[model samples]
Target: MIEALAGPQAGGVDDLTASDLLALARDRKAAEDRAAADLLVVAARWADLHPPESIHDAAAFAVPGCEHEEPIAGQGAPLVAEFCLAELGAVLGVSTTAAKKLVGHALELRHRLPRLWGQVQAGRVPAWRARSVAEVTIHTSPTLTVEAAAFVDAQVAAVAGRVGPAQLDRLVAETIKRFHLADVDPTQDPEDGYLHVDPRHATIHSDDVHYAGTMRLEAELDIADALDLDRALAHGAETLKALGSDASLGVRRSAALGDLARTQTALDLHTQGATGIRDADGLPAAREVVLHAHFDATLDGLTTVFGPTGRMEEGQRLVLLDQLRSWCGDSRTRVTIKPVIDLNADLSTPAYEVPDRIREQVILRDRTCVFPWCTRPARGCDIDHVDEYDHHADAEGRPQPGPTRTSNLAALCRFHHRLKTHTAWRYQMTEPGTFEWTSPHGHHYRRDRHGTTAVDQAEPPCPPDIPRPRRP
Candidate 1:
């Protein structure tokens, strides 16, 4: 079933019909995606093909029986970049500059927006979309500070696929306007007195060479003036909403600004709601979205996403959490700790069923398929009984089930679980948050909540006489 764990004939899934594949894909995607990302990274590291070091002299570098045994260039990251550009240019038939730009875009995303890069490796975000975000964000405000630029890029990457191209551009513009304003930076020199001319947008012009509505409106208003204009427009839109108007927010706000140009209006939530133009309490609170946190994975000071979803290395997850906290606010954000599986606790009464509480604990502990090096998030995996279950009839003809307790459970994404069932490889919960696995080659592995380590001891047995399953 290594083939099922991977390969074109994976888990025999490649042979499945479209309908069957669809259902299976949902369960297998996390494992498959993580596997794919790992494989791609591995492939990139391998020198068998497309080695960047070979790019300087494509015909000579690393080639067998080549006269030039010496290297073409000194080895370092810059050389890597140069070779990448040259190689890409050759393969794609583009100039080195264009290839450099392409490589730069990829490197920027990988370096700055790790979550987005992971999604790219997971095949969730396409190349075009990632490139689009990187390019337009750069174009929108070329002078943005480093902190501002990274914040905006990461924000755009987070909400990448939820919006369209035009909307993405608009969002980029909004983010730039919010973070790249004339006074957004606080450390600017007060001695360098430069005049900031107010937005000269009393004039609106459409395509100068055509009749299209597409136009550019340049602005340089004072920060307060810009904020005031936004508020007035929002207030006007709210007032119109209170009056039962069915205009879009953009349209209503634009009209509100025009009304403000003629007659000043105010943002008064209480007044608008009293007039029945808006909800008396303003808009309803945003609904909650589940963000699985692995407290165990939260070693030191970083929190990790539960599955193959998104992640950052070292303190990056901390940065992301701070950003999310800014968005979710203090009161709305909450945390729940999933204790390590006790190997002896039963939280439910259902026969052969892992109750939600116990299942959550195992998922938090395992964080992925318990197989060695598998990074599939536990949420997308099956809760397998480390000890094989035996079903039988008890006295008086009633059904008795195998123990469905925490100590007996481990999270194994479907493929690994099936692999265990179908082959000589076997694993058992040797202790709390620990699994000892024996591979087909008799190699022993210890996978715990932390990570995998090679072991010299044989696989241990699960605690015997696990309480019989609860009565039917």
Candidate 2:
């Protein structure tokens, strides 16, 4: 079955019978399981090679007070060196944060959850399924002990790792109760007198996935608070209707939330005015939102009719011009249009410090970190000079080796910035908003506004009669 799906003479997938298709799927799944198991082994070995003892000399470059080993697994697991995650992420085409989680799961499985690990090795359980269990155990609130993790491994292995998230949660909760792993003391704490775990939260998931100019919101609130919010939303929706809004109840409620926020800001401003409280700019503190939108030049006249799309940098989502207009049309909303910064034109400074204008341009040009597969927003990143700036050049009266200019600057998250500065990773800006990176292992990748691409290292062979260019 595997042979039929490989190489030049492989049969077309459309020609396969239904049974053959099923067989092919099974084969692919089995291969994936094997690959996942191999990845875990490799991750464990990588952790072993870059232990805390090995990174002592590199402590100068590490974040202060973060040079210690991180115990990512349960008891008896080896502590992994913190600095080794970034290179692994680059090699795996993932972010450093993801690579760290992978290493944590690998160590948790190998050292603490032996039963599930054995099942994974024997191909009886898929690596992802086992890793899911490991993730829960390793990240338990109080941190699961070795015995508790072993108990989870045995339970999961008995079912061949076919556990659902809810089931896994139940299992973990059971283990926590049976093993007395709760972090809070019931007798000592008045709020947790009944030993009940507090699980209240309100989460606004604005990053990552957004669809149709909307973001998902989730909350687990107390019954009274939930009822109160519902009543407020209902009242706000009614108010919008009274104000001649013809939208549906759902849409009106959503708009009502926005109005509520604006109203609160207004109230705060009024209070600040009464109390003589002002911001650094000598004005009452007000709510402000910075939105970056890119629109096509051709759509300037057709915006009303065609409702052209705009890229909202805040959430990195496409917003229709109509939606943008609706946001700005609110009576309480004030729209301020700032002068546009030309991304193509280079802006420079004489000193090493990056001016606010140059920094804003860099952020706008590169919406995220320039590192391959890094999604850290550029606004929060550090502006790094592609070429090291010579601070002493002016004092010594020599030409500037590196200028503080837009062309020479790129935003990098702290981790990748540190990696580029301290490790063997190197990158150069080929053009505005485009970066070419070469990893320590000689792997090359290109990152631009369009996204990341692996650059082939092999040079095209010259014709038999043609001469190859010689290096200087």
Candidate 3:
């Protein structure tokens, strides 16, 4: 294989034999797998930088500007992992779910299975095979875990690249048995265990012109419980067939299952003033998402960002609003009408405090920290004043306060908040929806509700480095 990798650049491929082609394909895949391993390691390392600062338990203090550096390892690790998942999804053009799986691989590779990580890095093991082994081995660790590693390493050294994913899994399972962890204890009481239903996989299969979404579910249940669910679905399917539904058997069965599931829980839904307002767990439940529709009839322009996804098509926004309004009375859903923003919304009285409603509007508009590339959800941020508040000098030489309104308010996560407060990152709101920030080097940037789109448009989060922005 090494010879095949060298053979391509060392000679011409035009004269290669069939065996040579096979070797080249295998070698190329090995190289690519190693590159993937390298990328995962780097991402894991980058996530380590902003170690989560623990706000609870025993506390330690860091000076205002350096709070990010003093957190213990694993402090704030979840947030960093979340950030990695979001940005990695964007970069890979994959969904957040897939990105999270990638992060799982990254963290496990870097921390739990360094020896296997090194094997992948050296191109001695296929990436999928290594990951399969890691997943099976992850929880089998104790002081006994070190022995498991050496045993697995010896097996791999004997037959490394020849193993497939299934073979690797079997090897790991067999090795784990030496430590008595290959199978569950049959003597344990079944009633003590809890059932779980999980979405095991959701995959997208597509060509340039067509696509399909496929999902598989994983569930654990007792034999009697499984038989009861099967009987219920069978009865529902028979009833649907008797009703003369035209769907195929498979489609009819699926519909029957959905109907049965909905019927089982549909009684819990309530109107705004309904007597019962609890979920299955008996907790109060109310719809919290507010859909915003921004339309200007005079200009014939309209748009709305929907669903917490922060992704909305401006062209269809008004149409979606109309459809939603039409469905309000016809469906079980409850809808409310509320104004999310105000034009002359200056709050001059409190001078620095933002009311809850206005803060909510700002958060919805921003969706995240106004700083570039920072995906910290705005709900947890400090609503910073774009223009710092201070006592104003009036025409009569009397003191006046600055206005605290939506125009001057923007969300900044804790780290960026301190950076802005203590550093030379000067900002001003030149217009209602735009923030103009100037670096110490006199570079200029514009941050609107949308994002960075002009000169000195901020660098990636954490660095606060000034990047020369380009105009669109």
TM-score of each: 0.33, 0.84, 0.51
Task: Give the per-residue lDDT digits (tens) of candidate 2, residues 273-308.
Answer: 665545554544447666767666566532433457
- Give candidate 3's total backbone clashes: 2
Q: Output the number of the TM-score-best candidate.
A: 2
Over 4 Å off in model 3, which ranges? 1-31, 40-112, 126-331, 339-353, 369-403, 411-472
Which of candidates 1 and 3 reaches a greater TM-score?
A: 3
Residues 259-359, model 3: lDDT tens digits: 65444553445423346555565434444434444434343443435311122222112234444443464333455655545544654345457888878
Lowest summed lDDT window (length 10), candidate 1: 69-78
Question: Number of the top candidate by lDDT?
Answer: 2
The order of the candidates by TM-score, greatest first, is: 2, 3, 1
lDDT of each: 0.53, 0.78, 0.54
Error of 2 at 61 (Å): 9.2
Q: Least lDDT summed over 10 consecutive residues: which range in candidate 2?
A: 463-472
- Candidate 2 Cα lDDT to native: 0.78
Model 1 lDDT per residue over 244-362, tens place: 98989987886676555432333343446534333233532233445543232343543335222223221112224444333345343444544555534545443677778888777
